[model samples]
Target: MISQHDFRQNVSIFENSLKIEFKVVIKSFVKLNKLFILWLIFVPGLLFSSSKNDSLLQVYNKHHSDTIGLNALHEYARNLQYEDFDSTYKTNVLLSNLCFSNLFEKKNLTARERYINIYFLGNTYNSQSIYFMEKGDYVKSLELLEKSIQWWSLAYKDYLESYKNEIYLGLSSSYSNKGSAEDYLGDFAMAMDSYTKALRLNDFVKRNCDSSLLNFVLNSEAITSFNIAMIFENMGEVNKSQKQYSKALELFTALTKLKDERVVVTGFLGTSNVLTALGKIYFKKEEYSVSIGYYNRALQIINSLNLKYNNRFNTEYADILTQLGIQYKKTQNYNRALELFDKALTIRRELGNKRLISISLNNISSLYYNMGKYKESLLASAESWKLAEEAKVPQQKIKASEGMADSYEKLGNYKEALIWHKVFKEVTDSLTDQESIKNASTIEARYQSEKNENDLKLLNAEKRLAEQKIIQQKADMASFQIKMWSAIILSLMIILSALITIFAIRQRHKRILKEKLLEEEKNRLRTVIDMQEKERTRIARDLHDGIGQLLSAASINFGMLGKTSQIMESESELFSSSMKILNDACTELRSISHEMMPRSLQDAGLSTALNELVVRSFKNTSIEAEFEILGALERLPQLVENGLFRICQELIGNIIKHSGASEVIIQLYKTSNEWILRVEDNGRGIISADTENGIGIKNIKARVSVLNGSLNYENGPEKGLITSVKIPIYGQN
Candidate 1:
């Protein structure tokens, strides 16, 4: 929609912008003049204003093979990058050659020395990246900066701990410069990330640093604050930008007040840039007076610097003047606004920066329209629109189109006004569509990135869980093996202990049984011996008392007969009596013998023998004995028969001798399982306790016990004594 004149103007602006950039590039490489060396030696400030320092180069050359030389060269390159980027790049290339020659791969270097070389290597790359950023090669700048980060990471890991802060400062500077280039490239997200990382490092150093490093950290923080403010400004968050600028300004002002001559220049430069940003922010907020005041303060700082830096300060001065002009136009001070715009235009023209010049012209056109100078506004806007197109600055172009439309409308040119309005609309719409498409693409990419990240996280977690399970399983297996071994050992101990104990207990029990049996046999033999001795004593007493008395009577009668000489019938009768006494003595001896071992008891069974015994015993006695048998009169075993017969004899003798009863009854009975004997006497109802426990009774009990039979002596119901013995016919021997 531009006329031929506008097209020509556009071509001219493009060519002029190229020429200006070439001129700037050429101007940046200032060579040192030997003639000025004496003058520079007199004024150190002026000495720093030059792009090169011979003394610094000499130190770098001398130490370039060592850490000291590399560090000096790095300082030299850093100082020159802003003023002369080509020199900085060339210097770093030479420094890299030195690193390559001396210590980069040399194993002879100490860890600290190698660490120093690595940091310088990264620093050199950072210097080159800064040079590229300043030269407006953002892609190359980002690439080089990434290399710097990679190399510096190695240095950070191996460097001395006390010097880690230096690496941190260097890294922060690299990231901040990277962010600036990204911001220029219109990569806001990456720029924000870089800025945030830079601030993170800055804050860490600032928080942990001692007083010696505090000023350096403050300087870094101030620079980072200004860089982040630009990001906020671009994002249309002017308030946030204002706050960040204010913070940067505060730090820079404090640094400047310290007047540490070594850092005062950087502090001043930082303060002025912050002030310029604050002025732009206030102008955006329509605070014209405040914006104007901030603009004046920044200009004053630029003016305060040495005149030798006029070229360095030119771009800064023009930017502030343009902001002041915009503010004055907003406040309705058309004349003052025009004056400020003209001043900015002259500076931008002299500087030969077409985009910046276009910005000044756009502002002038706006101011002219505001002042009702329609023709002047139209002319200024048309030129600005052409320059903006050449500069490829779409926002400036759109603004210039708006200014043109307004001027044409005010001048009552409907056709031109309509055309310019359409031009503005088309360009604005195109930008809007492109922004929308970019936002959509960004959203889709972010979603895919998040999904991939989540999937990776899940996979990593599963791998960790599997690894932990394997470790736990191994531990459990080891513990189980230990426990199994312990159990086996304990079981063996327990079994061994049990065997020993059982053997000891069994031996003790066997010994006790043998002693018990030996004791029982001795008691039996002693009992038998005592019974035999008692029986012998009883037989001897019987013989000596009864037979001796009878014989003595007989002997006396014979002696008397011999002494008489003449015989009488009565004396003859005394002889007869002596004979009869001799017969009776013989019979009594037989009875005693029979009682001791009765022939009838051995010859006949207990029934017949017992009957015969009853017949003989009571034949001449006053007390009668009755003997009765029930069941069969079977012969028993010899021991049983002998023991029973002896028991019967003892009972009969006791009855005959001791009982004062008139009669005795004896009964022997046999059953399928046992033999029983009962002897009752109608004598005294009860015996005294002494007679009950007498030797004869004891002997009877002993015999019964040997046959495992029972004997009882109790008073009968009719007032006699009853003796009952029961013998079982079961293996009676």
Candidate 2:
């Protein structure tokens, strides 16, 4: 037979050998599948690009008139917006200059020629605005958007009767671009208004345009709606954001049914953006798993499009990866999260985008902080801060500084931590101030615009009234009639006020009655709990006094019988076994009685009772149990103490019976106004099914409900299960 130490050594060797084999298998699989994986990643983008290029080539081969050629050029440039950033901008600039010098400067131009020129110019300007917006130059982007709107307005004025829908599409595109810039500038109200206007224009285009043009307008509407959703998301209006996102998704899904490849591709990309935005909103809400699902769907579209290497696609992919990493981190998949973060960082580096790089570094720093690698966290945070400063991005700077502060605190460097914390606070305050100023400006602009419109309406009405007064001479008599009716209106107002007062009084009484009912229900629950505890105490007393004494007497009598000289050897052995069994029965009864209403709980209080419970539960078991108490462990009310003790007992019992847990920790702590009890076990987590059926869990919930405490069960950071209960300690100093 193998000794215990030898057995342990053999198991250790086997585990080591198994791990080595697993690593070798993994490496071999990766090597064998490398090309297959690369092909999967590369093929979709190639097909998408090939199809798109073929369409553009056919247009170029047609060699239409200069005007048609210019239209084709614009379309080609638009398609390259995500594919080749620099080339798209240059092409748009060329197209803009060509339209201005070649067509706009011509004398005696036809209305058709002028309209085309204006449309092309507007389209070019709008495209340029988008380019600048992506580069983080919101002011420049906004200026170009305004120029685009000017050109679109000219086109609308010149040919509204003939091509109103077309002009509306151009104007809508321009306004959407404007909205994006305003959103980036933190002017959420303005962004919302711009997007609203864009949506309205797109709706007009959608209603009046032919099938082909209708699909285009629908895609634009989806894009504009997505922008509005993002603005709402930024403004913290979750319901509005979600509503708009759903609307956008519907529009984009419809567009996907179109036969036009360009429209179809645009629809797919738009859908992806909306999906990503939804993910961001859910991530903000801390619905990590839900957010991950949305993000993965978005990634699937990008993969399908085979556009992962496109500038915009790369940024989107990196962001998705980083966000997915964060969710994985929350779920405590540390190694997998680290791998994702590293991948995101690599992509950001390849792109050489400072803002994204800073974001990636800050995320990595946070991951390190969570992993307790403080020095590495500090290094990553410092680099992130430097990059954020260079990029002049306030949000990234705040995140990096906060990360650094946390790292310093973890490393026991309070001075450095304080310094970074102050920096983080200052930057956050600055950002808040900037947002406030933008909001004030947006409000003022809206007020001024509304006031001007109102003034114009008032002036127009006054002029019309002046003309009517001259034509009618009885205007003064009409004014007197209006004054006579005002007195009757005042009496009606008084009556309404009286009615409102009566309603208010009724509401106050109803509120008072509701409060009384709640208090009575609480009192009833308290009585029930008291009665239960009394019954338990009574039972424990009876078991200890009645059954326990009888069992002990039986054991003593049996022992006496076994010692008699007249007894045969066989009879004596039988007597000895009976006595031993009786003794064990007596001991078990005493233990059960003690457990029913532990004397230590009443004599020593909650902390000692919990500690003793932990010690007894795992006394000779393989499991290791620990108890910790924080803050002042004052004696709670008897009811409260009893409920807490039973809760702990139930959790421990569950752990031992079902968890297969190797280690358990029980903590009881007091805060300023609450007592918190936490029982955590290194075992399989409590699944939903287990929670629904477990009698012990049900009992625990009842006790917590009686105490008006909250009970929460969740997976721990690394593994196993954590249960936390918090009860407010009322009237406690």
Candidate 3:
């Protein structure tokens, strides 16, 4: 048998080896199959290229003689970028060299052809930069992005009017990519500057681009807005971040209403991202429930698209899961929180995302510490610290250090705890040092100043353009007036015709309005007639069921007494019972009559009537009912009082029947301007009040409408229903 210590050591070594092997295998697989994986992920657009693109590629390959061939090649390259980035990069390099060589050799290329070539080259560089950025190679991405910007700038100057906007858009995209790279590299000031440049370019495109291109430009602008929001959120500028996020949400929402399928998909994805960002912001603000709602909406979209396996989707999903875990942890749902954190960690590790991996590890560490698993927490913290060091993310490093310190302190390793505590303090202090804080503040201020300056310049330009437009309009107006004077008699005839048309339209509109009002009056009268008929039917049924039966019983009893007719004790008892039954029949008839139009409402006013109605409705029900009257009570018009009483009766009946309520509170109060009737119940609130409408609700709504009052139903505090009706107290009598 193996010694216990030796067996444990062997198991540990084996686990370490297995982890190493697993990582190596995963990395190798990804490296070897990256192109295939990309193609699969983008299969929707890549696997089935447009026939036009295919034909262009075929023509370019078969005959490469002139600018047409170059254009075809550019189109092919554009299609290739989504499918295979390496192929696109190589093809673009050759295309660029060929175009440059032709220019040098005096091959008579048109300016448009040259500009197209340059723009295509810039797009290729930008595409490559995006690839590198996704791979976390910020420096290399920055270099390529700068090159793309340069090429796009040149193209912007050379391109024709129709193509200028496209080139500017390309430049904007490149600058945005550069900003992302700079942000990842911790140069926030530079990142802000780059994003500002992109925003300006996007604005120019939006103002000048044709309607056909407007949607695409707007989508790009929304994306840039979202990115800027993210940067502001990272910089702790909550107000600016929220403003940009709101702007992005508005743009995306509008885009989703568009008819274009491509625009709709883009809008959905963008909207989901904005929602997730809002959720994070709210999460930080400790609005946990609101954050969860946003997160759930985002997750719904991602899952509905079946995009969980996509890298971008995975990243976002993991982020949301991690956030939810934190929320659950705060709520003391340790098991659920742990499960979510582990899921997020697994995704990050599989994607080989070092930065996110470190962050996830730190999160897990913190959760473990919260759970009081000091040993596990320390181990996770150590791994997190190592990963943070490798990723070179200061925030992750600080979080890991703090986790380690806490874990060590909990484990009674005071010396080690002190060391980590000092490290955490140093990192925290450096981040919040006066100089660093000042620099960050200065960067934010500079960004604002630059934005304001750009706005001023844009305003000046717009003013100049407006002045020119006004001058042109005035000249046109003068010319139009001169032409009108030459045909003054015809113009007068036309104006008279127009006046007649306007008069006819006005007369028609008045007739339609009058007809509509008459129709509405008819409907109201019909509703009142129907309600009265129904009430009569109900009263008739009650009399037949109650008074008629009692009278029949009493008559039979008296007849039996007459048949006995001996002045015996049984006969005497039968006569007394008959008298009692006859008395009840009379009382039942009176109650039925009163119910048709409650006598209490007429005699004692609305307050007493409502209280009596509640008492009668909930008399034997499980629901505890109470009624309260506030303010000085006075009489109201008969119609108003009757309507109020009927509405209250209907609501109380609804609560007893459908609300599953344990308690109900009905209040009638008078404010300075209005009378408020509130009915609250502790029960399952209305799930679909519109679709689940019963006769009771319909009756209440009709009565309220007739009274020119408003009725509202919503969920009450602590899982119940609240129904409020407000009527203007017009001269209470």
Candidate 4:
């Protein structure tokens, strides 16, 4: 009944939001510490690559296409991204097939191990994404990057809490790189959101991680800021762009103060790029002196890094020189500008990029015209034009043609200048025409798509109308049958009424008796609990009022005796130890009474009571604890509050005595229609089914059942146990 066009249009929203992830087949204990993980993973592949045989063959021979063979294939394919990916086409296809097969599952693993397993899977997709990006296939790259984000999110959530920050750093890197893929697909808005997320994650990691990671975090922060600034500049928001650039520079300035040499190399690279960007911004604003200063600063850093790191920033160095030369030319410093331009041209030639070479040549040609060297300017313009054409960049062609016309005019060649000017005007017009055509095509495509969707809707409407007509004819045919049965049904109903009334009378009496018995049981339970609370309160009051005061008075008298009399030193020490014993007994007794019934539970409510419990329980224990509440809190029915509080008290007692967990968290939160109490510990969970039948667990379940609530348990062998109890607020009464 569904039309094809309608189905596709309706499903695209869901289709585009789907996430694809996989688990790794092999296990490894390698630490996941940022992108440094790449070194650990790829170093093995690098060694295999240099072996006496081909690397892919070596991988196959080593694993023989078993489970581990999948891991080998993944690493092998990852290494290929840094080389010629086409050289091992079969390996790429096999790895992709294995990852998409989803045959492996995460099981029988610790939280940390499971985190590692999913992280490896994420990196597998990241490797493929990098390879496709290098090959200029952004659609496939975007798909894999999105998949990697999915797997990494799982890893981030499942990782050992102690190492969660490390896992988050890896996820942040994926987001930042994913933004690049989005940028290539012409989706700048999504890209901006992605970069913002990356910076925010780094802000979290910076506070909690080691100071050694400061350099790495700062560098990433600066890079994301620089990327955001570039997007702003592209959208023609100059003030906003300058603000982001300034933020990036400030981060870079801090990074330079760090002492980590390995990451400082990265800091230098990012810092130089920021400087170059600032120089360009100033140049646009016609601040020549300021622009020249910034460009030279960037040039110095790029030049030093290149010298020390084996030309690692050779491309950056060339770009800086070209920009600096343009600034110098603006100031009419012809000789110095020419020198810088020549240096840039030489470097671009070595790089063998047609576009960069054309850009350099055009800069020199314009400078020559400025210097009144018409013949030299014309020659450079002609060469630049040829390269621009080869590069297929229309903007470059426009600059080259305009430069040629200016050179010819300066030479007094009137006819040649006129012809070149006409060519420049025609090329500019053609560029505008091309943009108009592209826009028209986009509009036409949207119109066609909408028309197809509307046509499908019309067809579905017509089909519904035809089905309705058939239903109407069938109803008319059934009218005579209904009339015949009406009298027979009425007679049968009269006969049944007498028997039905007799049955109802008997059942109603039984139901009333049952209700009376149930109410008696409910009253008994309420009476017992109330008696227990009254008993506890009476004992606490007596202990605090009677014994506690007596002990305090005795301690004061003992202290006064020691101060008033000059007792011998050893005698004084013995008396002091006796006093300490009495004092500890007083403290212990008071604590027992508070534990039996916390004053806060009755005085303030669950949120304050839970916080007080955590403070009292962990004040001297080795275990760490946390308590949180969500949503607004109001006093609940007294029985509900008491039951939840007692249940938490028992849960925490069990954890402290038997769980061996170093960490625990208690949460009491309210939903719109329900209240939830959750207690979790990173400890040995239930060891066997019998553990659930223990007295403490049964007591918790009993309390939940009384409140018309449900309880669920998550037990982990390697780590963690969580107890979740949900009670409906509406139906309890």
Candidate 5:
């Protein structure tokens, strides 16, 4: 068994081995070919790096030393603006892959780190997408920008919970980039809407207010608006184009007044761009002086801020100079025009700004056309078209086409001029339509996604509430059941207590009544005994003095006479009948005395006494009575035993006299708690209502009361009469 420490060590070792393998793969890939190494390193860098540091290989190398060729690749990408299509394409592919890899890894990172990395990936994708757009690959550009948006959205999701403003800023920037892509693809309307949404989101967070950032935003917005204005102007919507250009100028002018270094540099560039747009518009309007004033302003700002915009500013400044040269040519100032062309051409060639070079070449060609130097002008315009095509700027292509048309027309080649003019119109028109379509689709997609998300959230909230109500209902039902059962059990307890109290009270009442009846019976017995004693004495004296002497004298005299007379015969029969009557009365008196108080019950015990009484009472009747005794009936009180025996006798007598019953059964059982006596007969049942206090029933009830017993009599439907009595012998108070 491994100890915890050893287990931890083993895990650490495993992790280290995995990390080493990862490092090996990174190094091996980086060491392959220079271009391949750059591709490998930059892709991961863009994929893994934060949004702020979008330079691919530099970001990759910062993360791990394993990216040995990353720094070299980053340098290569920095110089990518000068590379050919193939080089740029390869670089973009690498950057796109790097961003994808970064996003994959970013999922496992902490929320903050993940957000930063994904944001970096978004920026990389955005750059590549823009590059693709520049190459006239709108589909690929759209795909890359969508991926960028997705990543940025995820990053925003992570950030929104804690840093609401930061995420919103990121979202605004992502949307702005999307707008730019759409704009480039000829989707002007959708592009404008996307840009508007971005601005709104940007305003929601007040962080990007520093002059540099503000100027950056303003310049971007102005450029996009200016592009739209140029489209409108080309399409012959002069007023709309002017409106957009005016908006662009307003933003650019505001930036120029700012003091920040970055703002001042961007403002100068923006002001020049606005002037150039104004010059185009004025040239279309045939307003030379107004166009010249804007053109001159553009030239002054560019020359003054030359160092601020780096080498890039030289290209725009050169184009403006060529346009000025054209303006001079149009006004027939050939010397001044030629002089301006030379200055613009030199700057363009030096800076390798091919598009600007083409423009300056075209201007020189046009000046020659004005001077009637047809051969020189034709050669110049041809070279300018070649450079324009090579530069790959659509606007430059248009300018080059116009120059070719002019050169052709001046040489009396009207067909060629007309052909070039038509080509220029067709390309610009197609570009406008494409841009417009892209813009519309983008806005629609965004709006639909937001609406669906909101609807889903509402549905989820309602579902949760419904589930909560169901749970609460179940809880209430359970509580109700518990209370109901509690009430039922409580009621049962109360009923049990009441039954016990009633039983106790009834027993007490029975005991009192039994004692009272027994007392009354005892007093009656004493009075009967007293009367019997008095009668016995009177009879004895009468027999001795009168009847005895008379009977004796008569018997002796009659025997001596030996005569059969009628009077003597009658007297003898009468005497016999009288003696029989007397004997039956004496037996009945003895039975009554025994019934009132039985000596056998006192002497022979309950079972034996019960047997004797049943045999004697039923012997004279047709009833066949059976007496069954169970348990040890000896321990019970004499009074209780005697009372139970009498109850059995009374029940049997009722069956014999009233029911004309043929059979009677008496059962005397002495259980631990009580003595039970049951008497049943095949007889007409006694009516409990009528016979409750009749002589035999009252006597039995009195005796039962003395013993504190209970009696139950059922007039059973099939079995005639059933009487049962239970005396709780031990619990008697």
Candidate 6:
């Protein structure tokens, strides 16, 4: 079994190996795929921050305890930088959240809300600025940084004021970098002032040793001091230059002390770098022993720390070796000097440091020139010139041209030396002009672009904000309309429901009233019908008793009169006719009394009475009528049968009186819940208009309506009018 620590170590090693292998695989794939290669090239280091490891958060949290939430937000902001946005949308989401959290504090809510409406405006300006800076547009970078600083100033005036020292340190770094860019552009005076300002901030922040803040401050100061020292050295201000170098060393030392142990050895190595610079200075003053001591001290420290010497140290080491070589050559130790020069060249070549190689070559060539080995000196000088030209550094080019000029001059080639010197001057002057243009243009364009982008962003933000407001208003209006419509529909539904209830109730009351009126009318009609039936019964009874007795007495008297007048034959015939007339008159009177009351309909049934009437009417009339009967007509009441029989008699009488033709047909049938009666005649056709105007049609309509049935009178198909009526059974009920 592995020990716990060893197991952990193994796991870590495995993880690291996996990471390396994965990266290698990805890189290989990317090399094969152009699209992947493009993505890999531009994808990493995009947001310019790293993950918030414990160390970084600790740094942030220790400094910003007063605003832990803000510190958390800041950590989140920083962490968003490393998110692989190429394949993931999470980064954009996190970035947006970070932006909102940072900008939209309650303090800046109003302004931030306006700012976020355009979303990308302010962010785009900042992004473009950083983009230009990376593209070597130092001037543009500086301008954008300054604009960003101004934006932070306006946007976080209170925050900056509260964090005055930190703000000043940041401003100093910006100015210092701007100055360095200016220095590269050959604006040495501006560079000097900027470096001075940076040093001032560095000094102030150093006294207040807040390590986290001091890190940036001291780092900026060290860079600025180094730059200032270089400028002084260039201008031949050796004393000022040494002072600046010493200041840079002090600041770097102070920073290293505060750094982590991992970087502590590197800090000592930084001190070694200062020793090398000191060596160069001493060499410039012709203090050979002191210069050697500084150089040896630097080399000893580098070896002790086991540090891999970078180009800076390697170049410095080579210079010192060349210097030693030159000093030996002056002491007439030509072989020892040549050996030193060879050692220096080896280091230069190992470094692939062409500029140092040229310098080494120049030293060797000078040493040869001093020994009167003219041909050997020219060869060395030509090699140095070639190396210088290949190096392409401005200083290297000048040194190479000078070396060639010297070589030519020594060879007595005056024209060649003049041409090399002129070429040297021309190259240096053009380099200086081009460098100036690049630096100034970078600064100016950066500043203007930042300002223009900021303005455009502000405008876009305002427009977007206005659009959002309009959309919100429309949404609010729509919501209001929806509510209004719902309320209106609800109210109308309630009103309609109430109206239907009221209408139904009123109709129910009206129906009840109609039923009450019909009941009263039916009762009155029933009473009249009962009284008329009673009167008819009384008349029929009177006719059967008294009128029959009177007619019998009259007939007997007429017979006696006829016996007395029997002398002449004509007289006897008269008496016989009179007696016969008396008998016929009595019989007709009895029939009239029976027809008026219709006792048979009351005692027996309507069907028997109707059959007897039909037989008698046909025998009395010239017209022959055929009647067909169907169904059991057992349900007929006395009043209904009498009314129907009277109606039929009146219709036949009218038809016989008016019609010249003679055939009639009557049909009676009893169906479910109804009795149907139809009368059809064949006679001279009656005009429809005349029939409608007659009282008979009106009577038939009234009777049919009383029974809740229907009556129709029209010209029959052949020649006469047809009248039909259907009365519902038990309609009165």
**Best candidate, lDDT:** 2
Q: What tens digits encode model 4's per-residue C-alpha lDDT throughout 582-628? A: 88988987887787777888898777877888899888899999998
RMSD of each: 33.5, 32.4, 30.1, 26.9, 31.6, 36.8
Model 5 TM-score, all chains together: 0.41
Candidate 6 C-alpha lDDT tens digits along 467-486: 69988999999999999999
Q: TM-score per candidate, in order?
A: 0.46, 0.49, 0.48, 0.40, 0.41, 0.37
* 88: Cα error in model 3, Å: 7.1
Clashes of each: 1, 2, 0, 0, 15, 5
lDDT of each: 0.73, 0.77, 0.74, 0.71, 0.64, 0.62
* Per-residue accuracy of model 5 over 1-733 as CA lDDT, tens digit each: 1122411333444334534644654465445664555555445334323443454445555553223233333344544433233344566455444444443444465665545555555556666775665444556667776666665555554565675555555556656666766665456677766666666666655454554355555655555566566657655788998898888788777777877544556566777887887896787678998999999889888877655324446667777877787778777899998998999899867866555577677778868877888778878878887876665546656656766766766666656766776666665666445443343333333444556867656655775697689789989999999999999999999999999999999999999999888778765753554454446545554554465456555655654544544457657777657555555554565565555555576677877778888888888777788888876566456456645766776787677767767888888887777889988887777555667768888777655655557878888667578888988867553
Q: Alpha carbon lDDT of residue 730, candidate 6?
A: 66
Higher-TM-score candidate of 1 and 6: 1
Tell me the lDDT of candidate 4.
0.71
TM-score-based ranking: 2, 3, 1, 5, 4, 6
Residue 109 alpha-carbon offset, candidate 2, angstroms? 3.0
In model 2, state the lDDT of residue 561: 66
Better of 4 and 6 by lDDT: 4
| Residue 410 of model 6, lDDT score | 68
What is residue 287's positional error in candidate 1, in angstroms? 3.4
* Runs with alpha carbons beyond 4 Å of true place in candidate 1: 1-52, 78-114, 129-140, 154-163, 259-262, 306-311, 332-335, 349-355, 365-733
True-vs-predicted CA distance for residue 402, candidate 2, Å: 2.8
Q: Residue 160 in candidate 6 has what lDDT? A: 35
> Better model by lDDT, 2 or 3?
2
At residue 282, candidate 3 shows an lDDT of: 91
Please write out the lDDT profile of model 2 over residues 1-733, one tens digit for every residue: 1122421333444434534644554555435553354244333433445565556535644743257667776776766655667667876765675565555236776778777877887889898887776665667788888777766666655576888777778878888889887776567888888888888888777777887687778778888888888888777889998999999899888888889776787788888888888887888788878898899999998777765444457667777788788878888898899999999999888877677788888888988888889999999999999988876667788889888877876776656766776687688775445443343333333444545877655655785687688657667777777887887798889999999999999999999999888767766766776787898899999999999888888887777766665788677778667777888899889888878998899999988888888898889789999899987788998888998999899888888888888999888998888899998988988656865577877778778877888999889888899999998899421
